[model samples]
Target: MTPDDLADSELPMLSAAQATHLRALAAPHYREGHQYSLESLAHTCSRAPEEHWPDLVAAHFDRLRQASQGDESAEELLRGVHARLLPVDSVPSELLGSLRYARVVADGLVFAYALDGPTSVRLLTDRDVERAGLQALGEAARANLMRVPVRHEEVGVEGGARLRSVYGDSPFVAGQALFLAEVAWKVVGERLPDAGALVVVPTRHNLVYHPIADGSVVDAVNSLAAYALGAHEDGPGALSPRVYWWHRGSLTSLTVIDHETLTFSLQPPPHLLGLMKGLVHLDRAGRLATRAAAEPAGLEELMRGAAESMDRLVQDPATLADAFRSLVSLAHARCAYDPDVAHIDTWDAWATATRLGSALFTGAPAQECHLGEDLVWQLPAFPAEPPADARGWLDALYLAIVCRQTDRIGRLCRVPSETLRQDDSVDEYVLHWIDTLRAYFSDGPSMDDVVEKLVATIETSGRDGVTHAPTEFVNAIDYQPAALFHRLIARDHDTFAKALAEAVAEHGGYWDGSAAPRARVALGPLAMASLAYDYGFPVDPAQPCLPAHLLNRQRLEEFS
Candidate 1:
């Protein structure tokens, strides 16, 4: 009988002709009732195509017959055994004696030990567990499960929640959630909040989790629950359709199922609710403080407020890097546009950002870039690796080159242009600018090639009037390369000066009526001018975007 015939019947039973065929295909050692029950045969047939039913049934019976004899020694069995998670009530009462060693780990889930083979998985029986010793077997299973290689990726969920998914083709992937704490530390490190995380093991090959941080936990719970149900239903080795709270190494079910209605919903316990509420309150407070700091104000006051509120405003390494970029932008704006703002004030902001960035990214303290303290090119221990975000890496490379720090520039260049292209958010023009700077600094390509690429980008961007960069940043992205190429490679002082003025105007327009300190400067133009001034290009000290005090580099000479 076909699979559809079995599905339409009240009892999934094989017909006489099908039974005869299955019996003929059975292994020589297969016993009729013990190793090849009619019910088991029907179930296997329903899940596989009729064309391959013979081989499948033959292999299934052979596996059962081999498992029944238990020829392998306990030591050999322990080597391949691993923890397996199964749906609740999946084991029949008659087979319960064999799986008595299994324990309930969470709602709708049973954790059991199994010997994973190339072609099949054999669930350990109570007799096998007794011989291996429960403690030794448990340890061996966990160790074996952990050995499986898993890939990690971060995905953004709706409502501003981020989920980390760890998956593998191995059948024991879901069981790794049993040791979620260790995995969280290995993958998340300092990013995992003190409150722990929300977790879901949907199928034998997938586990997704969100580190509990703020009010977004509510959205994360709903998203994870929906994902779990869908993945479980589509699974080759389905495990659970429930969400669980993983707190301090403990897993508790967060899903509540209505048996009568056959539906499920997530409901966090009181303790978890209280924790989430507290995080929500803090999140709101931090946002309010950031808003206050962004109000119309003097650059120094705004910088001071930002530095003070950083701990509350920044949540992760990514945000910390962004905060540093914001501060750098503000320092550039102040130096370029606000002549009244002291160069020392701009240096102070840079020093503060560098210190915070160093602490966060490198776990090192940076020496203060004080006024008249000869610029120490290497005082701050830069992060060994560049930021993964294309924009952040660009900002870092700009700072390194403008400061004339060869070591820092070399470190940043280790990241190839192709790696930066992976971030789709960055504009093509911005990437071209990065490539030009990398090639120029490293002497990797001819200056003519760089100029040709820059001119082509400018022509294309001007013709299309379209850019991949965000609306607020399009002008800055367009103007940075033009200004840098003119000053550095073309040696066209007049063109460089014009490009600088346009960049300054674009910066002002972008930050018009904004109270944030970063609105005061155009960092890209200032960096380009710094390079020109160093190269003895007669830059107009009174230029709108090039602050004279900063161009002199007297402060930078203090370290010398």
Candidate 2:
């Protein structure tokens, strides 16, 4: 570990590309959080000057949100939480503008995992990270977090040749997280030092489906992540660890993050949002004037009117032509100052009113169901490379989960009585017969065995006898709006991390990490990007820069 050892040391000097990663890992020197680095970043072709690499890019985007504070020019749009746009031009638009809204305005997200081994499986939450505490979990995590120092595993199918394009001082996960967090904080602190409050919170939630119940084993590695987010020196921004995981047959553990006004206004497109408000006006007009006298006739007449009104609103086709322009105008008015609505004043109000009316009229009966947008949940995307150190991934997952909950909320005007409230706890939901199920799923050698093991996992975990948790965590596999949800949003694996936890706690997976095929660092996001492009899901087109080679996971298009 000494300089003299650099000459005689087996530790290899980083390759040119690796050096670039290293520089990024080391970029926090000018920020308050990081100490100085010995290696010079100036001449390496690895470093970008500090100005171009200004601290947290999130702040800049957020600043744009603040600037649009009083844009009262657009009245109808500021009226409600969502729009009521439908894609009835005979077919859907190739690139959806909706997904882009979720991608950018996503308040927070969570991605969790249920790791399985020969012994047991356990839940890993991304939301409850405590940085220092996790950092103190000894060498394994330290080594993994600073993985930039080591060579990446070869993942190409053809041969074992290493991927030399992406390199780092240590592993890209933690090292980059620390760098970004550090620099981002300093920059924000500098920009808004006196007027606003600044604090960083890491959410705790688990992603990953597993049935393992061995607390001793689970706590050992999982606590590392918990500590990282939980143990900050001082509160910086509003964040906390959030996570998702799978337990038995359920998806559990969702996270929530504080949403800035701009991001809050970007979700819930018009397709499913055209219900409420339009009816409010009808209510005032005493439109349901003959409910007592006509009963079904009155209801039927109301439906006919609502439909005709909606038809006129769209059928004429002269209302609004560009959807994106409408959304942009809406985002500014809503998020900049974060005010409450006194009247249906914004441009989006017309749409929200229609949605409100539709929903209110449709739900006159008990236990009734109304259709909404199919929700596609996602796990967290690691800011740095993966396998993300548990702490970093958990934090990202926590954010992702919060975003999912926001999505869930967007689909609901008011949560049903059965839905898990923000007050639910993990212990009360625990399945009792977890041990038997965990043992049952341990040896399935084939896919068939994996299925049997999974079924056993569900049965055994459910034996805990806990009644009615509601559709708190509905399975995308069986949800009613599954197709449409997939059309708009795709699952981030971490979104369901908790779904497998109880099952794993009761009965573990049949295989271990060593048995499964290895994954490429590029695997998850690459697949996501391909899906995004193919289906035309909306994503923020903003390009994120790193210390390394230009381009961001291909999410940001390359500049040729």
Candidate 3:
């Protein structure tokens, strides 16, 4: 530990290639201000008896030399080195009492087994590690072992390794987790008591732990992950974004945050999340059975309560509402300089706010609505236009529309008792808005012209007392006429013709002689003339707007 010892240390000498590789591997640690010397790193490598020292150093340096520029291959190469030299899991009876040790050697990794009889360290070879099936274990050990000194306080002992700290000074990277899990299994396994270990990751870097129940090793690990996610700090980077159940050398299960937005948007999966929340809440409330396993009766009752609450949350709509409200509030706070909607709660309030939220929050399309799932059942009637009432169904509907949730939009579209009202065409308006959104947001067409033509068509139809036909005609072809006409107005006749041809093809050839051969065959001339007039393009009188139909009729005559 002293400078004199460091100077006197007889460490492994590295070949030119090995030294270069070590330098490259050590670059990151050096950049982060870790000044590790070859001798120091060598000392840290698994200690071995004098006779085995040379081979161990050589193997350790060889491992370093094999690493690529970025050490991306560090794990694989290190594992190879260990597999070659370490005793396999199926070892001779004589070696049963020995213990294997893993350590980071400067930029490299090293392993050695201490013989029980002689109390001497025997360096492991690559072949030995492979035979032992200890590659994953080695990888885990090397990765999780802290390179930097962490401010740690040992909380407990599990298996052979000590529970060093509840939370680490920094966040666990993707691979360190594998090591932690491996170590946990090695040390804790099924011996973990009923009060599961509590692992709290306030940030990706820091993790805190306490015992909440007595359980097996795997259960304890699972509980730790669940608690980390449910109980961590709020907002991005403040909390662990996700947690995983690590066992058998890899992560088997992980529950992500933002279940609704990220997984199932229409409905969030509540069971696992509820279980997670239940445990964390129990910890927070001091209601857990004991610091370890709960007394049988008390633990059972508490668990029953947790289960009931989870089921109730799944069945109740209130949980959904609360989660959405929180997320919307967060979004609003994020947009502090220019928030579109004020925070509103309660079913009635959200109804009216849905409309305002849609209009004001029109920064970009969101993936999900802030309105809760309960809004669907308690939805009030929507007036012809979006009502001022926050409780009206249109409020939620508008928000869904603006958020660009097509599936939710479809669901909301069916929720209204009456699809239309006096002077207000609810379905038509929704369809129109969806088109406007797709066009504007996707950059498929000009928004100004699309809106202008749609407005003109609606106004013209209203003035002419042509109720529903214009809208129906527009919807039948899936909102392409306006876009086509916009092109036509720009004197892009070629594009218009090409688009029209493709549209007809998609709807089946116009003269198929079916009841609805063309999607809007009955209103072909009217729809064409309406678009032409709206955009200031003159309709060609001699041309048959229903070209396929005209051609088919002539073909029939010729056959006859």
> Which should have the higher lDDT, number 2 or number 3?
3
Q: Residue 299 deviation, candidate 1, in Å?
A: 11
Report RMSD for candidate 2.
30.6
On residues 261-351, what C-alpha lDDT tens digit does candidate 3 reach at each position? Answer: 6431111133323333334432322222122321222323432343343234335533332322322222222222212222232222223
For every model shown, what is its TM-score relative to the native structure? 0.48, 0.16, 0.21
Instruction: Evaluate all candidate structures by whole-model CA lDDT and list the values in order.
Output: 0.63, 0.24, 0.34
Q: Go through the candidates in order and give the C-alpha RMSD of each one to the true structure.
A: 20.9, 30.6, 23.4
Candidate 1 Cα lDDT to native? 0.63
TM-score of 1: 0.48
Model 2 Cα lDDT, one tens digit per residue, 159-211: 11111111233112212222222222332222211111111123111111111
Error of 1 at 413 (Å): 54
The best candidate by TM-score is 1
Clash totals for all candidate models: 7, 146, 41
The segments of candidate 2 whose C-alpha lies over 4 angstroms from its true place after superposition are 1-107, 110-211, 217-226, 230-240, 243-560
User: What lDDT does candidate 1 reach at residue 29?
Assistant: 45
lDDT for residue 87 in candidate 3, whole number 0-100: 12
How well does model 2 score by local distance difference test? Answer: 0.24
Q: What value does the lDDT take at residue 399 in candidate 2?
A: 19
Model 3 steric clash total:
41
